[model samples]
Target chain A: MATKASRAAARMMIAPSVILLLAWMIVPLSLTIYFSFLRYNLITPTGNPFVGWENYYWFVTDPSFQAAMLNTLMLVGGVLLITVAGGIMFALLLDRPMFGQGIIRIMVIAPFFVMPTVSALVWKNMFMNPVNGMFGQIATSLGFQPIDFMGQIPLLSIILIVSWMWLPFATLILFTAMQSLDQEQLEAAEMDGAGSFSRFVFIVLPHLARAITVVILIQTIFHLSIFAEILVTTNGGPGTASTNLTYLIYVSSLLQFDVGLGSAGGVIAIILANIVAIFLMRMIGKNLDA
Target chain B: MARAVSNRTRALNTAVAGTLGFLMFFPILWIFILSFKTEEDAIRAPLEVLFGSGWTLDSFFTVQERSDYFKHFANSVIISLGSTFVGLLIAIPAAWAMAFVPARHTKNVLMWMLSTKMLPPVGVLVPIYLIFRDYGLLDTRIGLVIVLTLMNLPIIIWMLYTYFKEIPGEILEAARMDGASLREEILHVLTPMAIPGMASTVLLNIILAWNEAFWTLNLTAANAAPLTAFIASYSSPEGLFYAKLSAASIMAIAPILIMGWFSQRQLVRGLTFGAVK
Candidate 1:
């Protein structure tokens, strides 16, 4: 029953958002792409000569680029492994017939609400600091030397902090999915002499496969650009020990004043994120039809 | 039918889940406790910090007095609320149109909006920063409000679209049949029906905006700094002041935490773009 007038109204209603989003996406993005090919430095104020591939070459060839790329992959990979594994265990536990389920859930989900800066600094100073941190205190009391967490193993430390924040998200999603599981199937498997482990393996896992993928893909999108946690805690310190690609770009562009180099890095980041986005969009798109 | 579990099994599950939950929540719990202690007492070992300290609100007062905590808190309130408000205003019409009068390319449009979210912020950081610098929007609440509103517009539209889709078309049709104007139909029927969904969207967006650290930290320096940036400034020698840092962190996160608890279900739906449910 959509007449021409209604269709015109509908288009009018959608026009503003469409136009604004179009501008938001295209303007800055084209600027980034254009600047990537020019030797533009804010501090030097030199002539903007077209330097095709030079910025990309330097950004890639930089020693820190390799470290940042490796660190970025490790951070994302490590946090995913921990969150997914820990989330499954938590989801299974929470899904059981247990007392105080609501309270336990509230407690578990609290960390996800804590801002990144707060969580990072809390972990850095209160738990991981060598001198006055809780870990140090426990170690000294137990007759052991306190290990320097941020100093010795910075990336791993960040992974732990980030994992703590994200574990709740994974658990909540998995738990919601688990709750929708078909009880009859589990009972059928049980009646067929399947043990609890086998029931979880055969029946419940398949049910949870989609949810797990959702968690991994969604978390990867956020984790790949973990900027605040690293900024607040490590500052990518100890000589590029914990710098991710995002942080590397921030360093080059904002800190080091190399707009062209940073824009090139930004372009690389967009490409990397787009790769992940393609898979994620496919998954979400499949779900849309379902 | 739900199976009856043994009492022993139920108790075992309770114990296990409670212990694990507490373990997962210990850092927040620890900070909450430390926030009430004196600075020196807060730095003591865990056991002593827990038992040996006298409880006081001294650090809370000190944090306010020293850093003007209320200024940052106000910035967070204004920025988060402002962004969410602007986003909802822009998004409601777009979502409403897409939901009710969807054309062939509606799905593509929705997906395109989502793809914008996946574009790493770092990708556009340079141009946006320079734009802000040149336009004198740096470190201004208006600048942050504009940026965050745009940043969150896609999610807002997706969320509102999903919610609006759940609404039956017949209600709007019936309203139309009754000779209600389009504006009256939306303001009276569609809006009331969509309030719950919109509330959830607002809550989730506020939580996201409040905890947003990267842009808030990078774009603002002092005047318009939100609590996220405020807390980050403590990441120095002064951060060694455990009680004060805890107090500041608690104040910064407490509002969002309470709001977050209410929005967990909506959060899953929104963040996953209705993919899970």
Candidate 2:
């Protein structure tokens, strides 16, 4: 029902955001693609001659790159497994009538708000330090050797830290979805002799399917580029044990000044992210009209 | 929805959920306790540290004195608030337009905006770094503000759009039918209605921008480092000083944590872009 004037006004109002985003997406991306094909190094700012796919070959073939790729997959997969499972458990429990639910929820959600650096440092020093950490203290009191968490299992340690931060996010989303579930339908199933387990499996799980998908897609996007947690805790560690694609690119481009290799890695990271993004975009797009 | 359950079951459920919640919150609580203890006491065994330490505000003072903490805190406040404010300025009109006057491509525009957010920052790290260096915008607060503004613009617009979508169009139609000009219609009728949504959007974005680590860590050095970068500096030898690090961390996260609690409901909607709801 908008008039010609309002439609024109809408176009005018939308121009700045559209133009800015278009530029924001285009300029740097094209430069990254261009740079990926050249032999560019920031430190030695000499001739940057075009080189075809060599940077990609080297970056992909490098031993650290292989380790980084493995670590990235493990980190993302591990955290998703923990957070999603934990989130389901938490949502189920929280959905039940409980005492002090608000306080408990605040406590649970608090970690997600803590900045990555703070949370990483807190976990690293206060809770995981082998010499003086809480876990070490507990281990020693129980007459066991204190495990060096970051040293022995850097990727696992990161996954735990990240999981703690994100479990709340998944729980909150799932819990919100659960509130919309038909309680009477659940009751009717119970009346029809469905056990609690069967009811949960058949009714609640299906209802939660969409919310779970939303959680997985959104968390994957954030999880794929977990940077500060690794930076502050392990610095991609004892030997790139915890290095993800983002950290690997950061090290090469910013630290090593191999702009070409970093750009190539950046292009690959973009491509991988887009593969996930297409799925997410499709899901969100379907929801737009509804 | 409240079932007729026994008190024993309720109590059992409460205890289990409470314990799990406490475990999740333990690290933050531990740091809070550590922040108030002396450096020596903070490193003691967990039980000993809890039982034997005399509480003091020394570490908080020391964190302030040692690193000029307020400068970084101010930078964080400015960057997050400035970016959110600038983002709102650009987003309000766009969101309003899209919600009220959407055409054929409006949904495409929104989905595309979100797609930009998925473009991992690492993808353009090289060019952005080079551009910032060349333009002398590498370590400036204004530069950080601009980057964060663009970084968060899509989410800001999406959130405002979702919120705006809820406001009925008939209200605007009524306002226009009263011979109100477009400016008067927005200022008198729409802005007031949009204020609460805008406030929640502001709250969520500020929390996001404040805690954003990647750009703040990479783009800023000493002069313009926000709390994220400032806290990251503690990763070295300074990190060994447990009480000081805890104090610094508490200071950095406290404001956002409180804001987060208040905005928890909006967060699900904002982050998921209204899909779950």
Candidate 3:
């Protein structure tokens, strides 16, 4: 609430953004919620019967639902692990005042900036080609037949490529956290005769606790919707070997043209995303309090 | 004493950092070299391909002929910049209200906005696609812009709000006390103080909006397709065009890749701001 002058000011200030965000949030979302309750399909007219929760029931009962769920969890879990672990190590290296640090950072960060479609394509062809990819070439040079990254280990290949793309982001965020660590605290710990591991565990990790949480939550939300890599590299294929929830929806709705089932799957994905969001919000809430 | 310790540790650090650098950089460097090589050389041994063969631009030519690079580029520029501009226009005022006024629900509201981001787009893809069709937004730049802006709005607002919070409330209050119009306060004072933060936020959001693929691919068929869609087309029905695809990938990613390269410090600074502090 504002005084007459201030209220007008506040309203005026906020009106444009409020309207835009309102439109942004309201239109598509309400349509989604509406569609979730109906038997709608792109191939059919919009006048289809309102099948209350049948779409949801159909979606929940599908065989692919469990696989997609598991795949989503696995990809998020796997990518997060690789990124957080690699991020920590790389951040440690980057935080140090070493030779050519600037140039090295530019190189390390290039992948994160590369268009995902392009990077996925690059990995699909130049690196993971299996016939003439760099990986295949390396394998043949070592006197072994090239293993098809997409065919032999489809999900793992996607996971590795996605992880490679995000690891730099993790490192960048964590490295900033590491740099902001209090030198005085470190010296005090050292004065108390703490070893390197002790200092890292007690001092550095504690200092990084917030950043770590931020990294986990932010990366979790984004990685759960991993689409471009699957589309580019595997097409959710080698027989649904790489289909996560997102790809499943795409296949169901676009490829298979089943909007009812796809909408249901989409609702499930939102619920799963909300679970993560709730956990993140609690962390943010707790942080705000402290 | 710490200087001497830093010096002593520097050598070991350099060795570790060097290896990490090389491993991290190898793929990008390899792709860079491949972008210039003929299809034949691109498939050769890494050692010889790196040193043995003279580079050619045939792949680039093939890419140019196949994909209209400029149309895709224009689409990317329009979508990314449009989203950022639209996002900021809305965010600035909303952030101003919360930052200046003591609203009880401001935190909850902010959290709610961000939570929308966590909702997987796939979950709502069907509905959104339907809505776009019903509204005649499909295969239109406006549809891409609105979706991208919405998709990115939560983070944009969060980033802008965080920056806005840093400006001392006393200043905004003083502007109120001075009878400076809210417009004056925002345009004349608040914006200037926060432009650096806002500029970084704008650049970072452009990058996020630029790299977005799911919505662009899903919502767009042909008319509104961006660089991501451009690259996606190269993975064909008969087989993947490995060499030409790389060149197309190179062409598609080069603009934003270069943008990111130039604006690394700013992007990282904005992304890592609150967590670091």
Candidate 4:
């Protein structure tokens, strides 16, 4: 009876939020699904009659879709690689005895808190600008012609900026996890003649496996929809060189005012996100007992 | 011999680590220095002008004078705090339910909540915008707060629930057996025990809400504009003033940066709490 009463209470407590999300999710998704079949544009509202997947057909055939898809994949994959790799190094380094480690940690952690727009703006102007940016200055000093970072390699620049912003997160997680490891085991390994690399591989890396997965999964979710940096710096430009799926949706709905097509693009993004999420969730589920 | 070997390795590690840390932070540090430069000096080749010109607060003054710093700051404070509190209000009960009296679908429910977060806001953005427009809720602080709260609620609840779960259920059961009401079980017994978790959740949510740019930028115009929008406005192709732009960027981000510096440990803890657990 107590269990039943608690179960009912749980249902009651969660009901409002669940119902709200239900409407929030189903309404837009169903509308988007319905709109995907119609010739809908925000500018041209007369796309009322359903055209049987014509919108999807056009969206799939459009050259920008492939670019957007690849860009999204590259952005997500690229940042994850950089952040996770750099993060492990930083985390390990910070976990050991070092001078001014506190101050160094603070400096490293600062970028995570910088507003995305502000960070992007600073990078675009003070750091990445071809004429006066720090990068340009360094390149010139090194006897190499200044590279317009955004113009020449727009996606890579964005990826680097994001990696910087998120590396702290990965480091923090792995560091926290590393700190929690049993020190005796590490000393034991040392006493038994395990080299640094062997200890790191056998002990530290295993300890960080869950943290690494978390970093990858969480970052993937957020990075997939990265918009602020791209908007502030590149605006998906030099001709869609840096266009991601989210920006594509933005251009369609907000820029072109094509509601139907925009909604279609949105649905596609949702499906893609779900696919990534499903893979991540399955991995997490498998690792639950580990 | 062993001490010498360890010392040499340690020295090598420190040198490498220092360089990596410096590289990671150089852009932000350069931006801070550039914010104090004159427009002309700001655009000078970094090799020529860094630590070259006399530092001045003139850019800061101009940025403040040009933009209504207080108004934007106030809006940011209210929206971030309002949503975090509002989210806490709803999340407390929900988290309590899930943490203490979880149903069969508790993990599923939590996963579902988080999955909603993964859905690109653009997917439902048009409908929400239409709803907001039709209801005359566009560009209103209250509307922005609600949206921001909704946006961050799942993670807030997740974080709080994770915190709450660490509290033994037996404690709550004991309180109930003492003739305590449900509220007393939660308020008197449960919440107090979970203060650390709750505090971390609040701080983490505050940072998330403060840093949130997408919904704030899209839903807000002028009256409801926050710092994210303020920074976005600085990137006009015509201005070409890196100094003022960097100054504005600093102004827009300083409050949160200060807050984050203090709570960095707590935020990192909350973020990694569930992942490792």
Candidate 5:
């Protein structure tokens, strides 16, 4: 029974959050778009004159932009593949009745809580370092060469580190979904003489479809803008080898002080993120209606 | 629907799951162990370092002595708590309204709020940095608090809305019918009912803000540097000091890790925006 008075109060109550979020979103975004067209460099004290599409042209034509785009896709795709597969396997094992289930779940989910910088550094120096790292020590003791992880395959190393952090997230969500599956359906399938593989394929997987999609969409949003890990580990080093779009933009705008180029890159990143956001928003929108 | 399983099967499952779980958790466990070792022993072969190292709190002491650990820790506490507090202040009213007295466009508003979160922070980094610089807010805790508040507002509102929606409006209407004023009804009825949800929202937001690295690293230089920035500084040649690095990391993540453990179930709900059950 929303009367006129209560409806007015509702409007009043929602105004602060709505207006603040509007300002937060629109103001800086418009400014970024405005800066993308201008030739602005913090280091050079020249006037920021609008240069049409020149900044975008240069940023796009730069070979590094292509590399960053490729690396971004690879990193996102690689981590998604690893985490989703690993998550399913872990979720299945965890769903089975076992001793110390709580402790095992806690251990599996621990990495997700470790901040990116700490996780990256731990992986970089303690585990992946070719010389003084544990891997190196083991390799040397075993009369073999220690694989230079970050140096040899920077993106893959990053992929592994990020996957470790995210696998728990996927597993937790999927496991929750698995726990909610209809037991009668599984019993029915078993009674029909279906093997475990067939039951999993026909029953459990279908039930987990929504949760899998949720995990993928949510993870994609976060994975697309992976920054701190790359920053602390590679700094997109060895000449743009590990630079994602976010890292590329950071280097241009903040590190190199090329505001125009960075803004253009930012716009591109926004567009890329929006492409995925559209799918996510639609999915959530449908869920809301349901 | 109960199925009987043999004891051997149960033991085998436990052993396999435990081993895999330990493997997954070894990095953090190793860091925890190393944080107590001498610097020289921290980098030794894993087997030797685990079995032969003399345990000491030297690294913990040196971390604080060398790098004013408390300052960064305080910064993290202030920023994360401050942002969550401000976000709740703004979001609670909005979520309450949408939940109880939902307008026709309520779903649209919710989706719009979430869309802002989807806008990658990098996209607006240049302008926000310049704006902060012009306002003399760079490297300040207030700036971080403001940014993080905005960054997390959508999630907070979404979570509170989901929680509040679970609360039936008929209860409030009945309270009103019993002659309770609107303010009293909210204070005495709705708020008490929503406490658990709000507490979980606060917790998940704090964890998110505490572990936030991108904005914290980019915005703060020295004075307002949080644990994220503090730990990132150790990423240089000094990162070779495995024991000290481990100590710093353990300190940085300890509070959030505990909080995260408690909030894991809520985290799934919050992160997915209740899209999944």
Candidate 6:
């Protein structure tokens, strides 16, 4: 048991981290909230007079806003769909007794370690280039015209790249969780004449429910602000085809120098992230006690 | 695992899973191969590039020569390691305090810290950019170190707390009963035990900060750019130089890739905040 003196010392020890994180969250965030209310433009910095929700009005009503909102949802949802489903399949496959299990796992998990910028650039140029990309060579050899992947299907192309990066993460988590499955129970069910499909549906899937939820919520949080892939591959272009909320705000604030509008978009992004954060926090918090 | 598995079934599993794994790893493997070829050979049809191209180290040399690659490499090293060490310094005492002397509000404090991590970086981009501009911290490695340190502190604390929780408290109690001071107990008895957890935490944090793209991209231009920013410059027309781009990418990712393989187990535990484990 901690004595009174030790408790005091504990408080002292914990102060720096608590204070720094508090300020880290509070200072810039409050400034963002403050700037969102003003008509601040870096180009015309004569005055940043407070404009009551005008930035929000313009931001939300902008046609690109609708597209960006949809794109963000699609990117996050598509990645989640692919990663979760692919992760489950990979986890199941890897769970089976296979040859070179260690090497197979290392190969499967390698993509997640590649920096986002490297992965994006490599995929864009090496694999996706219409004329010279590997896919192009394959298509041309097969007598089909090569499709410019980033140009023709920017969002889908972005999704494919992002899914490659994340599939490893989802698989690694699900696979780890799968290792904890009750093998005797599975064997018993098999002996009771349950088919493999029924065994998976009744037993394995239920066990992985928590890990799957963790994967989705965590991936959603990261996916909502995917910046590097879009910047490198698409630059949110082909007429804003792949522009998501994060890139939209990036363009407005940094590129266009519309601090007010960008800050407003930033606020909206924060709100959207908070909705997911609530669920994630609840899940992880429950685990803290366990 | 104890039960008998047929050779046919094992072979089939190998075939299916190996194919999938190769597909998953194809991009990296392809790039690795491309990095060793001439630019002319790299863009040729896949079969020719694989079978016909003469291997060369020219691209790697050109990539290093044309760009100041090592400058960015050094920046990546400093920023990731600097931030991790700084974060660990701040987090160790806090995590220890919370783990060993948790009070009524410890859980809420932890949950609040995690909630801060959930705050999207974009939400505060404007102010942070402006502040960095005014303070002349923009494009500075120290600025990134500070930002990333704050960004990763919560996870560091949470991870250390989880690891510390696993070390039985009764040992400390026994030491205290033996007339050991609290400092002595921690330094003599606890520090050695905590090293492995701390090392893994350091490893995972380094991997994260090394690959961190958002702030590294936005905050830095040339002076403090890391490999993420450096490699991003290839997004220009130069990206068409397949051999050179592949070479650059391979160099950038290779170190982290090796570290990642070693940390795969810790990666799951670290990212999930011990939720699944």
TM-score for chain B considered on its own, for each of the candidates:
0.98, 0.98, 0.90, 0.90, 0.98, 0.98
User: What is the lDDT, from 0 to 100, of the residue B196 in candidate 6?
Assistant: 91
A1-290, model 5: which lDDT tens digit per residue? 88899899999999999999999999999999999999999999669998999999999999999999999999999999999999999999999888889999999999999999999999999999988888888889999999998888999999999999999999999998998998888999898999999999999999999889889988998988999999999999778889999999999999999999999999999999999999889888997851
DockQ in order: 0.81, 0.84, 0.60, 0.53, 0.82, 0.84
Candidate with better TM-score, 1 vs 3? 1
Estimate the TM-score of every prediction: 0.99, 0.99, 0.93, 0.92, 0.99, 0.99
Pairs clashing within candidate 4: A41-A259, A42-A257, A42-A258, A42-A259, A43-A257
Candidate 1 chain A, run of 10 with poorest lDDT:
A281-290
What residue pairs are clashing in model 2?
none
Tens digit of per-residue lDDT, candidate 5, span B96-207: 9999888899999999999999999999999999999999999999999999999999999999999999898899999999999879988999999999999999999999
Candidate 4 lDDT by residue in tens digits, A1-290? 24787788888888876766667677777877776677766555684787777777777788998999899999999999999998998898887666667777877787898889888888887788877787888888799999899999999999988888898888887777787787788888999999999999999899888788878887888898898989888999889899998998888877887767787888888887887788666665553221
In candidate 5, which residue ranges exceed 4 Å CA deviation? none
Superposed model 6: Cα runs more than 4 Å off: none
TM value for model 6: 0.99
- Weakest ten-residue segment in model 5 chain A by summed lDDT: A281-290
**lDDT pick, better of 1 and 6:** 6
Error of 5 at A23 (Å): 0.5
Residue A33 of model 5, lDDT score: 97
Which residue segments of model 1 deviate by more than 4 Å?
A: none
Give the Cα lDDT of each candidate.
0.93, 0.93, 0.79, 0.80, 0.93, 0.94
TM-score of the A chain in candidate 3: the value is 0.93
Regarding TM-score, does 2 or 3 come out ahead? 2
B144-245 in candidate 4: lDDT tens per residue?
Answer: 998888887877887787778778888788888898988778778987898888887888888888889888888888898888887888768466578888
Native contacts retained, all candidates in order? 0.81, 0.85, 0.67, 0.55, 0.80, 0.89
Measured by TM-score, how close is model 1 to the native structure?
0.99
